[model samples]
Target: MSTEKIPQIAFNPKKNKVLGVEIISIENLMSRNQKTDHSPEKAHVLKFNMIVLFTGGESEQLVDFVWHKVSKNTVIYLTRGQVNAFKFNKNLKGYLILFTNKYLEKQLNALPQTTTIRLLTSHLFSPKIEIPKDLFIKKYFHLFYKEFYKANETHIDTSTIHHLFVILFNKLERLKTNQLPQIKNTERFSIFLKFKELLESEYAKNRNADYYAKELHITYKHLNIICKEVVHATAKQFIDDFIILQAKRALINSTDRSSNIAYAMGFEEPTNFIKYFKKRTGYTPNAFKKIHS
Candidate 1:
């Protein structure tokens, strides 16, 4: 896939609109433009949020360089700026809902520090959740699909769409809490979510717990407390993991040399970089390269 040519489709009212939303079955999404489009299986970055809800069948999706295997009743959420590539089964049965962040962001514009959207944008971080399909829940996707395809309104009442998303996100959050391994941790780890959000944006420039703590306007101790509460790890360890993961991504996906990568990751001493990477990953830069190669 050409990274530069990642397809990003906006809500085209002329095509289909539930006011910034569109829903298509996985079968149709795969074949909709096969005659005219090239590389339909290639990965692309999204400019809007896309939610794929599967009723049955199995498939895998690459999200931000991580591959997630999903099956029946699995829900995969992809937000703007995330790279997504699909590898679907022939009998892929699912609902693909695409919606613009523009309208949703405004309604959820309050800062993470200010209001509790209660992680309304939480899916941006935790993207996959699985729950068995029920007639009650399957109805939303059908209703959304119906509304989106039938939307002929010139000026759609966005409130209806916004309410739909609120219900959907809230329901997913509840399921995520219940279905995830550590049920109790989700309740008190709101700060952990903010930490991840900030780290994704700031990790390259700042990998220190102190910097993240300051950005979140919380004491370093408080940040560590939240990290332990949520991930059973220290804030420093999380920061290190974040930086190391970014370095690994660069090593795997980029053509840059180890020395250049070390310097780029703010390693003033190259040996420190090697030691740090080896400490966590058990592989020196060159060794990791050879293995991946």
Candidate 2:
């Protein structure tokens, strides 16, 4: 069933919110889509999680500038504020699950911090997972999808949705843990996750490790300890890596001037930004763009 056609999609943003979750397909959402650029017009940073489960056909999703394959049994996961775009086949068949942070955070809080919860929250982990398409897999989505629409016909039973959500999460955990073992449940892991959440929201303005440590009510030394224990890196290195990644994403995806990109990224001078980028990446912003563009 493999084809040689390259993935393509043109996108204009649309508000795709439902009561809590929006399950859709590219075929159904074609109005906001098009085919031309292998890339999106610009990078997309969503405020919610977008999960695409490919059941048929072939395509690619440009997630944070990495083109991930979308074929049978492939799943793409995009976390909030992570860049993504559709470079995809028109013939592809898949279910796209979009749900808000509020919805996901609320649900996870009600459950224990199991492997499933870790997979759902860890943003640095791989964003795509491929699993076999079988009844066990189909059952999870079917129950959730059926209950979602049935509630629309009758009445919304939040519990029904949550029950199905738990089952589906476990299935996904199995796939993720196979690739990356579940992180231990410890104070360090908890601290690292909290720091990560804060960084995702605050990385743009507050790049200092001390700022994050203060916000998390932990010492900077303690934060470094937690980060090294979990990710094998220092807290400051993690923050800088995130900043550089966002900068690179802006440089490669947008046509804005380098100075503009630097200013938007909170640098007072373009020279400093350039130096910082080159120091971390060994290439000037323009040079990096030359390779990507």
Best candidate, lDDT-wise? 2
Candidate 1: tens digits of C-alpha lDDT, residues 1-293:
11233354444544535456666888787776466353445555577878889877777887765689888778888776566777866877888877786655665642232223333433225578777656355677776666555555655445665666666655665666553434255544667778888988877677789998998889999898877766667999888877876676566555667788888888887798899999988999767655443
Compared with the true structure, model 2 gives a TM-score of: 0.69
Question: Which pairs of residues clash in candidate 2, taking residues 3 or more apart in a chain or in different chains?
Answer: 8-88, 10-34
Candidate 2 has an lDDT of 0.70
- As a whole number from 0 to 100, the lDDT of residue 196 in candidate 2 is 84
Scored against the true structure, residue 61 in model 2 reaches a CA lDDT of 80
Backbone collisions counted per model: 0, 2
Identify the candidate with maximal TM-score. Answer: 2
**Superposition TM-score, candidate 1 onto the true structure:** 0.68
* Per-model TM-score versus the true fold: 0.68, 0.69
lDDT of each: 0.68, 0.70
Q: How far is candidate 2 from the true structure (C-alpha RMSD, Å)?
A: 6.7
